[model samples]
Target: MFRTLVQNVPAVADTSDTSDTSDTADVAVIGGGMSGMATALRLQSAGLSTVVLEAHGHAGGCAGYYRKRGFSFDVGATTLVDFAPGGVGAELLDSVGIAPLNAQELTGYRAHLPDREVVLHRDQSAWHAERLRMLGDSERHRRFWALLDRLAQTFWQASRAGVRLPVRGPADALHDLRAVGLSGVPLARHLNRTLGDALRSHSLRDDAALVGLLGMLVEDTVHTGVDDAPLINAALGVTIRGAGLSRHVGGMHGFWRALVTHYRGLGGRLRVGCQVSQVVGGPGHYRLTTRHSTLHARRVVCALPAARTAAICAGLPVATRLQTFLERDAQALGGACVVFLGVPEEEVAAQELTHHQLLQAYDRPLGEGNNMFVSVSASGDTLSAPPGHRAVMISTHTELSGWAGLDPAAYEQRKKEIGERLVGYARRAYPALGERAVIAQTGTPRSYQRFGFRPDGAVGGPRQRLGNTNQHAVPHDLGGPGLWLVGDSTWPGLGTVACVLGSRIVAEGMLREKGFAR
Candidate 1:
């Protein structure tokens, strides 16, 4: 069971004043998501005057959550991973003097593949047993697991030590080279390789069931099927149980509030409902135009998606090409469609369940109706559900363009149809979900655009394929003098862990530029 997220600390005074509309700071971070908050808080703690301008009413971005009819649903980010002691999340929380949230340890999720059902256990022995049972005790399976285990270990260890790809500048390049050491050498060979490459190497590429299973897992995590998912990231994605995945006690919304509390308690200024319209200055000195006022800062960290970032910097001459590149990348990313449900507890009393569940049907396309990642809150968790109800959040990838160019009525009808289809499919896993299961709400890419201010609700970061891995991925340093990008769209790619790591990378680069450390 997870610990309760209960931290009672005295509130720090709002040190930086925005009431006078001074609109000046040492550093200004755009988009108060996970990355933006981390960057601003770390810089403020480092003695830099920082302010966070977020378009949304709350922080957490994709990690935000909401309540409806007494049921709480996690909007996008459902779990906290890689948060064990000394892990990336742990280290970051430690630095901020904030304690880790109470989380329930996941014993791996149950994968309902097309042909078979398998429980991917967190424990090595259990996983080995399951692998042997489903994949058979063959040398190919052993070799594949061996390679993934090694690659995952190296990738995670390097991340824990503060090493990320897509070096920002000379200082970042130097830091990366040093962080690589000998452990990262093995990872280099797989930089350009994909899960398919490893499968082919083991002669298991033709195993339909194995390929289907991994494809489901990899596609959900890296936004690429096994055929194209880079080995380094896919390896980490497949073996994530070793790192740890947990559900926050009160849902992700609680986590967001906790993060905001910690940041504000540190006297860091956070201004929600402030949208950055444009970026109009150069390195060393930049001016950001918000809906209400214009703000200036010496350094800026942008945590918005590439499209939004590009729009914000459209006024800069050097950023024209950068904006174009970001636009292209944004178009290439997968869109998200989420469905929330509230079911009576008695409806599914006979079945066993995990905190997270993934099911994929191989016949359909990669996104669309082929796959779904679902999360269900434990019964009696009043924070997320009523006493006799269970809250469920389901999501899957969709083509961003599909939601565009539709009339308002058509869009609403399409959303309704998709929601019904998804709910019908979900009942396959939870058979009790008949009319008794209430369809609380459904959200599409358009919903994300309205709330997150993203162009297409583009999420899950960049696609981690053959040509987009490691050094080839979108960079943290945008080559602008004082401009830096953090979050899923760059460097370490997507996920909460990647965002935190990216923030650290940006923070370190900023400190170095300030002559804090090498």
Candidate 2:
């Protein structure tokens, strides 16, 4: 069960005067997701006047929550890692004055295969040892762990350095040099020559168990195959071991609310239900024409997808290289998710199931409910469910184009069918799950598009390809002066850590441009 630490801090009454806009701020942040919120809060604390415009009524984007009949459900992410002490995510939260909660540490992740159940322990050494033991005395696990450990340490150093500096020209080159220096080799070469060759040569071809385990890891970490993903990015997951992945007390939305509270406290202004229509560069300033009114700022940070940026800045010098990168990166192949609520605690309690379970049906491929990751949040937690009822969230990846041409009626039907299939898979693990589900809802690529404001309902913006991957070519630079971009489309792809890290990079860039000390 998830728990919260109650701090008796008095609420700050809403002091925003929407009608008053005489002064232009240092920055105008478009989008109020975690990345946007992080940027606005940090810039405002640094004594820069900042305004955040959110198209949605709420702050969180995909990380938002929904409620139906006393049940609360997280729309996007359910589980998060690297939020422990000394971690970048934790440091970001603390820097904004949001107190961290004492979260319950999950013991292991259940991996269901055709013939056996694999419980991936939280401890790295123990998890590697168990895998070696399970594989019947194979030494491959030992070698894999050693390589993963080196990669993780190097990636951590890169993440730390990247979060602090601006990604431009020679500075970006130096950053890459520092990352390689720390890692002792180029990230791409290391992945292709080491991790890639090792897995292909030995395990993936022979061991079904190893393939299943690696499949789950790759799917969870990069939302893609091992060969297509960067080793540094993949290593982030390995290093996260023993860091105790935790869920927000109420739901992911509660975390968003907490962040908004912190943002407001830092004197950051947020305007909701406001959509940016155009971003025109004025002399030494940026004019953001919104659906309602126009605002001006010395800098404008667009925390949106590449397509959205293209839509707003229609007349800018349009970075052709960046545009090409966005086009190539637009492949959203991650699958859809089906969330169920109002599950009875007693049904799953007897099975010793807490809030999480992984379901695998031997009849399907790895991406098609062959393995389903399940999470449960207790009822009346004000975060996940109503009193006495539980919330279940399940996710799997699919090609973005799969749901492209369906009409509304067809879409709804598809969702129902998929939801039923997932519910059936869940039943194999917990027999009584179907009877306990009071509410069944499905989020397709179309739903993600409607809710997340993504062009193609790409859950994680722009897939990070292995080679020709320009880490600096990310659309963080807005193609002109006084404009920037943040969010998942930036350097690091997805996850809470990536969003926060992208925000820090944007803030640092803006600060340097404005002559602020590091």
Candidate 3:
């Protein structure tokens, strides 16, 4: 379907528009994260001249990587979901004609709770048996699991089939309904529900072990606790192990390098360190103001977080629209605390898998290192670290507000405490994780704000809730001509796979608007 979308469109033109307009293109992508890169490449392949303006010097916004002292660490998100054969990621790669990813297929990770360790296997039957053996084996447990498998299977397939959601109009409503098919009609009842609702229906709401496990998984994927996690969204979250989770052989560093190479090879323009400060004018005459220069494009796709998008498009009609959601997401916007360590391979080799999710205590609140995830690079992936060393990234969610208004001394003190706490928590999986680290550093919301250029360092979109996700999600078009939004902030929500799905929706819409498609 995508192979011929842009085959007849025109390529980028030579810019003789003077220093005032140093760059110009048929489409301009305002962020170089997964969503922006995907959309730009799709549009570029469709025959439109495209330029991607990234504030950061490198690619992959939250999913990006960094190097220090011969060690490379993924900044956020360790695994790629549903990228294997017939999955959304595979479809995207096929659509763009990029070679399939060289990722290490993972069996799954071990979840370390305060009292028990559960192995979440990728094999469906194995996971079914394991969950029954570990979490609960009652009929109610079976019913709950059955509901999740049903919803997850339904929606995951809809997404893979290119379902467009968060209906922006009558056309979208029809398109999405058809994409879902008649078989999925009954699943819509869950749209108004929460994961808690499902548990309640099964009379398992009080099951702390199960709730804690679900909470940890839900929070990581949807940025919300189980009670408030939208049912459909949570379904996809808890069952991702069954879908597939893989860490690139060289980690995100290798992933970004490959993506950028493919995009550039397609003749797409990538301007890093070029921050867009303002966007003015309208469709086919949009003006993007960057710190160093200005870029003009016929269309604009912003993959920025909502807050950053609001700031850059300050006075446009979309700014007001963005603000409404910004206020709704104000309390929901969260950040991350990451501890990157360059440790000896032995430290990580002791673990059964390269990834582990640790919940220090089921009763305690989730963040501030109580619940953390650890991702260690493959032992022989030399691109991530020195031959015998490995790069380890430990992350936990945090509300951005918690890190504000601190004195320098106080901030430093807190950063130390949280960083140490996370490292300590990670020890549950890799007992020797940080004992003899060659390099250890911590990052807070402020660190993300500084490096990722996100407003308040908001990492994921608003925590998925009944009112904030699914049919209520922020759509691609914000009532601005030629202005579009994609990324974690849009439909399908966070992670590599979600962003890629959003890219497909936005790219197709851009093409349709330009009459580049039927």
Candidate 4:
């Protein structure tokens, strides 16, 4: 059990005339995903005229949900971690004055490894006993875990205290200094290091079971394995269960509906089904052209992916770092394959845990159904399923290119094959998982590209190697004065919490750039 996410939404300050049809605002956020919406909400609350333009029919990008029959399937992300009080998501909700929707705080999930099953409990002592008893009980294991715990604590401190990246000014520098604190200052040394370095230091890098579990956590969170994931971030990722993983009552659907309502109630303009094809002009005033009209704004936050931003901002001055990131991750971007199933509750009745990560063979690489994450909606949660059924979503990391360049027949065949393969993998954990399902479908990289608007169907950020993440990750502030980027493609890359953190940084940066902050 965990603390609830029901807080009162404080009244938001009305910043602009909502009824104005001029398509002009003080700021224009290019996408309406989690990051874009959070940024625009904060800016609007701060009394800045802001508007959010989403290409999709509604918000929530990868976090978005869709319904088939009576089942609601989350498109990408399954849970919100570090979302309790004094956590990253808590700060964003508190800032926007929107109370979070009802959420079920996860106790933990069962990680079914080859050798044993480890329960990732949210409680400190339970998790300690579980990991040590399951992964390893030696001194080396203890030491590695101790280091990870310390690093995770340091990252959470910086996060909850409102850390911003790129250190835009003395103000930003001072904020980071205070947020990181003297006790945590030394931990910054871990930034350039990789999780492999930490594990090797403890002489536990060769522990296949331990490393495989880390790969499961980090690959899902930071989008990398133990060897390449940045030390500090991987630490946070591995410990997210401790920070708290909360699944909304209706999953992302309830969360987004409430958030969009809060934003609109605050008089912030949100234009759905509006795709901005070109962003021309900058250094103050800018013009965003969509099929409907050309919106004018003094500031523009290109919350789209790095590659898409590069494409649309042809006339505007794009940043060198952004282009560098686009090229660097063009072929390397990771996508996901998801299998959505709606089955009777009895199918999952044998499962004690609602969420599970199954790795059939630890020796096998993590992807293409080898490492599968299975999530079942809460029993009797009618918002996500029918009265006697539960919504099940199983997903795994995938190579985007594998799903590309195939003819129609080949593509359909490949999709069908992958879907069946994942369902087969899930059977090891939930024997009746997708049996007798009323609704079943598969989503591939091409599906993501079509529906999510991600370039080449890239899902999460880069593999989060030491070279491409942290300071080297794409900055929120592009070179142009009014230009900015926020999303999985940017710093603190990928995840619901990361997007909120990125939004906070961009909102603060924009306020300061517009002379609203000290």
Best by lDDT: 3
Between prediction 3 and prediction 4, the one with superior lDDT is: 3
List per-prediction Cα lDDT, in the order shown: 0.76, 0.66, 0.84, 0.82
Q: How many clashes (backbone N, Cα, C below 3 Å) per candidate?
A: 0, 5, 1, 0
Best by TM-score: 3
Query: RMSD of each candidate?
Result: 4.4, 4.6, 5.8, 5.1
For candidate 4, lDDT tens digit of each residue in 58-122? 77788887765656778888788777887888887788787765889999999988878889999
For TM-score, candidate 1 versus 2, the one ahead is: 1
- What residue runs in model 2 are displaced by over 4 Å at the alpha carbon? 1-23, 161-168, 173-188, 191-195, 201-204, 238-241, 318-321, 332-335, 351-365, 378-382, 468-475, 478-480, 514-518
Clashing pairs in 1: none
Clashing pairs in 2: 250-383, 334-398, 335-397, 335-398, 380-386
**Model 2 over residues 326-354: C-alpha lDDT tens digits?**
65665543645655556766656654444
The residue ranges of model 3 lying beyond 4 angstroms of the native Cα positions read: 1-21, 514-518
Error of 4 at 439 (Å): 0.3
Alpha carbon lDDT at 340, candidate 3: 89
lDDT-based ranking? 3, 4, 1, 2
- Tell me which residue pairs clash in candidate 3: 6-46
Residue 436 error for model 4, in Å? 1.0
Please give the lDDT score at residue 270 for candidate 4.
81
Better of 1 and 3 by lDDT: 3
Superposed Cα deviation of residue 115, candidate 2 (Å): 2.2
